[model samples]
Target chain A: MTALPDTTGKKLGLVIDLDTCVGCQACATSCKEWNTQGYSAPMTDRDPRGSDPDGPWLNRIHGYEIEPESGHDSRVVHFPRSCLHCETPACVTVCPTGASYKRAEDGIVLINPDTCIGCKLCSWACPYGAREYDVDHGVMKKCTLCVDRIYNENLEPEDRQPACVKACPTGARHFGDLGDPGSAVSQLVLERGGFDLLPEMGYKPTNKYLPPRTKRNTPQAGIEALPKGDGSAMDRLFKLADRLLSGAGN
Target chain B: MNPAYSVIFFTTASGAGYGLLALLGLTGARMGHAPSLLFAILTLIIALGLITAGLLSSTLHLGRPERAWRALSQWRTSWLSREGVAAIVTYPFALAFGLVWSGLVAIPDAVAPLGILTAILALTTVFTTGKIYATLTTIRAWNQPLTVPIYLFFALASGGALHWAISTILGMEPGTVPPVAGFALLMLAMLKLRYWGLIDNAPRDRTMANATGLGEHVRQWEVPHTSTNFVQREMGFVVARRHAQRLRKIFFLLLLLAGGLEGAATSVPAFAVPAALILLIAAWLERWLFFAEGEHVVTLFYGNPNA
Candidate 1:
């Protein structure tokens, strides 16, 4: 089972937009809030109210300042990091137990806690740090792409999506079958020139990231004086009436 | 990257045990010529004891040690699984080699073939263990051509030193043991130096720009969490350049002293124990450096611009 399947039915993944992300951490917070009680439950925190509070989290937001080549000033870009669910993930093949596996139906990589030995080798094999060891449970925890929520029939049709995607206030995070060329997410990727993180590593990740767009180039707006009215008694009377109605007298 | 003590001890202890086991199996034909029956038994006991203790220590690091048996199921893909299988397969051959050499079993004619088979299996187990680290592409320091060779030679040198010490103590003639072990120690020291050089000069190609798909000059404004997470605590372990250089110097001094003492043990038997002891310390230091200095690619997301 550690050996990956040659082909998958669909490559369901996310496309994150750096330009629109505000680093508000809504996605990360919502991920923790939902997942703590969802599929990988009891996501224990060592010291929640103490100074060194730490726990396992699937989504994390990073902030970086970028200096452009020319014309644009330096700006802060917020980046969200998570598992890409790669086509050839070393993390899957390196698992000694069949606990770590990639779903052939949806191309979603996941860990089976009941069978996991928690040797932590899968964590080392992952370049993106997607796997986190659950110290209390003695098992490995990961994103899972909100498998419990995405396919649940109990919720409303619109509510059936990854927690992070549904929680993104700016609509920076998108989820769909990226393997389909005609899908809306695929079209968005084509329009924005989406790229993969650490493409040189050759994991062939499914998820893509759209780079921050260039700063807009437009002049600042300013107020201008009104042209003199045509020399006419009626025009002058109209101008005086407009000034009185503009709250100038108050 | 955290340099866990359990792993360092496991590799050093088990590697030396396999090395010594292989040597014993090769010399099985001449076991009757040993000083006494007790010598052969003691040597086998030492080898097996080290192996058992090391195997047990390795499981201590696992979060679910009770489920460790599951590790042996994936030899087709995982090197760690392959290592487990190899280690188990070598044990029966090793025990048989012991019985034949101890003059207790009546397989006198099978000595040569059994010796060769046990030796092969022992070396194979060591090779699989080395591949576990060498195959991980996430750590550039461990993912190199020299990683496996260094591990192989260190096992030979450390085990050879122990063999020389034990033979000299038992009043057996130290014919080729001292010289061969000394030479192996020399080769190990040279290989370690080259490995350090290669890792130090490894190119920093995976940078912040490639990580975030941002512009070239990217700097971390702030990390996601204010407190340290599991990734930072485990993979973000960093050793300062000054401290690493100092450790390297200490390792070199220990290795040179151990090598010299191993060579001198041929003339004076008193030098044998000290030489093996020093070599053991040097191997521990080298193993510690191996983990402490390794930088994982995951660190790039935790404010490291390059891996």
Candidate 2:
């Protein structure tokens, strides 16, 4: 069962826009809130009230300072990392108990807590560090892409997205069938030249990231240019100040 | 990458156990006179005990120790499962070989076949253990061609040292075992040194830019969390250069002294136990370094992208 399926009929995945992400952490927090109570409940904190607090979280946001290079300006990029639901997920195949598996229907990688021995090899196999070991329950927990919400009939069609996508204040996260070339997300990827993270590792990640857009030349705000003077403004001002001081002394 | 002691012990102990089992299987049936029943029984007990202890210790780190049995069911795709299966399968053959060697069983002809079977299974188990780490592309340090040979050679050397110790204790002619063990030790030392060199000089292919799909000049200004997370704890192990160098020197010295002592056992006959003990310690240190120095690609996200 650990052998990956030949193909998933639909590659459901996310497309994130770095240019739009505000790094507010709403997506990460909402993801934690939802998943903590959802499929992988009680993502327990080992020392919630102590000096060194740690816990399982499905999503994490990292901020990077991209230095100016060539013609591009410097910018801070907020990167939200989660499981990419790779077409060839090493995490899934490395599971010794068949506890970790990818859904053949949608390519969403998930861990079956009932079968998991919590050996943690799956976490080591992941290049993105997507899986979190839940110490309290002794199971591996990860982003299920809100499988409970996404497929629930109780939710409205528009509200059926993953919690991270729904909670993104900047509309930075998009979820759809990435396998379909004509999907809106796919089109956005095409237009923005979205790229896969760590493509050289060759997991063939389903998710994509839209790179930050290049900065454009613009005038500074709230500042006015000084009037031109032939005498040179700084020199004239110094001379005027000197004359005033001399007159006062006389 | 955190070099959990439980796993380190598991690998080293099991590696030595399997190596001893393999060597016994290869040589047991061919001896001119059957080894003393006590020697045979004691050898089997030590080898099997180490393997069992190692396996039990490995379960200590698991989140659910009771569910460890399920790990053997996924041999179709998982190297861990394969390792478990190989180990389990080797047990019956190894037990049979022990019985036959001790003359507890009536069939003398069964020794050769059982020994060969046990040897093959032991080698398979070790190979699967090596593959468990080597197949993980996420860890550049472990996912290499050198990993398998290193595992095999270390097992051989440590196991050889144990075998030599037993032979010397039983008052067997020292000429028979020490030479082979000395040779294995030399090979293990060379391979280990080469592996270290390879990892030290290897170019890191995973970078921050590629990891985030950002540009080449990207540098982490802030990590995802203010405190350490699971990923950081599991895969973000860092070793200071000075400490690592010191450990390496110790490891090398211990291994070399073990080899020298084992070789000297042929003349002095008193150095065998010390050699075995030193070899075990050396193997432990080597295994520790294997895990401590390994850099997982996932650590790139935590401002150590270059590591």
Q: Candidates' TM-scores?
A: 0.92, 0.93
Once superposed on the true structure, which residue ranges of model 1 sit more than 4 Å away at CA?
A68-71, A217-250, B29-35
Error of 1 at A22 (Å): 1.2
Q: lDDT at B290 for candidate 1?
A: 88
* Model 1: docking quality category: medium
C-alpha-based local distance difference test score of model 2: 0.88
* Candidate 2: stretches off by over 4 Å: A69-73, A219-222, A225-250
Cα DockQ of the candidate 1 complex: 0.68
Clashes of each: 0, 0
Each candidate: fraction of true contacts kept? 0.83, 0.92
Instruction: Please write out the lDDT profile of model 2 over residues A94-162, one tens digit for every residue.
Output: 899999999999999999888999899999999899999999989999989889989989999998999
Q: What is the C-alpha RMSD of each candidate to the true structure, in Å?
A: 4.3, 5.4
* Interface RMSD over true interface Cα atoms for each candidate: 1.1, 0.9
